[model samples]
Target: MAIEIENKDQQHPRAKKDGEVVERLLQESANDNNLAEVARLRIRYGGFPGARSMQRNLDIVLERWNLTEEGLFELTRQIHAEGRAYKRNSNGEEQEDWT
Candidate 1:
């Protein structure tokens, strides 16, 4: 498990009791390589009820995992260009543009 080496005693206690659950959601999402979903859920449940941890760590995770908004956008663009994540709808909206 990942933990702050300096905070092994849990002295920091930066997160709420329920924070671990939310973090678990993020961790499981990350474990499955669903960084996009992780980011999205952080935006969704993060601002909704039942959320414990603040959304700031999304940036931390992104920075730690080297995931940035620009990076994800470029990745989406590339995937779309490669026909891996783009399907034009009947309307002008995008089918599955995660960015």
Candidate 2:
């Protein structure tokens, strides 16, 4: 599923750059087998209605990485059950560890 910006001229340069960064991070995390980070990224941007471009970029990343969102969530849930998952505080900051 290739996601191309419908109107390249209408998209802000910064947004495009940020999307690229997200793509890179997702790819790196996938390559490193960092399921936790991948899950984090999904939580951060999945279904984010505020940014259509980012959402499209995320879909592209998932397809390129050969990952399904459902599978990622299942693995993440298992990780959480094992007590090896990171938690986010009310401030949306990642805690050092679940402990």
Candidate 3:
């Protein structure tokens, strides 16, 4: 016999707010010049998954560009938001048109 699992229908209350935050962060990061510092701040406080992995990626990116904390929070915020978006879309939630 096969067992079927049902998915929940409730929408997360914070989804729209989170999306808005990510959009704002992306816009801010695009115009900021101190990306290196921003990367450092994200590594320190973004609470992203695989802390070591995020730090490593940040370090690699920093090697080629100068950055600062001025806009790192927004950058990291976008990174995490994108990750969430990918997971949600993959799981069959409404897919956002990133294009």
Candidate 4:
């Protein structure tokens, strides 16, 4: 006998809630380069089993942002090549990590 699983498209309630937050954060990051980096990190490393909503959010961002996984990785490569990272000053502004 063959069995089929149902509700495969359903997302967990918590995941759905988190996805909304993720979408909002991504939208806010558009005008903030520093925040963009943080958002990218969240998208890249926040994977877990049964995180359907979060994954869907990431897919939407990638499509809407017109960015590919390889492009994102290349951006990271350039940042590392420059030996700098986004830092914040005491005044809460983005600064370069010179050290």
Global lDDT of each model? 0.49, 0.62, 0.43, 0.55
**Candidate 4 global Cα RMSD:** 6.8
Residue-pair clashes, model 3: 9
Clashes of each: 0, 0, 9, 0
Tell me, by TM-score, which candidate is best.
2
lDDT of 3 by residue, 42-83 (tens): 444354433344344454444334444444555656665566
Higher-scoring candidate on lDDT, 2 or 4: 2
List of clashing residue pairs for candidate 2: none
Highest-scoring model, lDDT: 2
lDDT of each residue in 7-97, candidate 1, tens digit only: 2323223245335544655454333224444444454444443333345555555666667767755555555466555345789555442
Q: Candidate 4 lDDT, tens digit per residue, 43-78?
A: 543555466656666666666667676765566566
Ranking by lDDT: 2, 4, 1, 3
CA error at residue 57 for candidate 1, angstroms: 1.9
TM-score of 1: 0.36
Ten-residue region with minimum lDDT total, candidate 4: 29-38
Candidates in order: C-alpha RMSD to true structure: 12.3, 9.0, 14.9, 6.8
Per-candidate TM-scores read 0.36, 0.49, 0.27, 0.48
How many angstroms is residue 72 displaced in model 1 relative to the true structure, after the best TM-score fit? 2.1
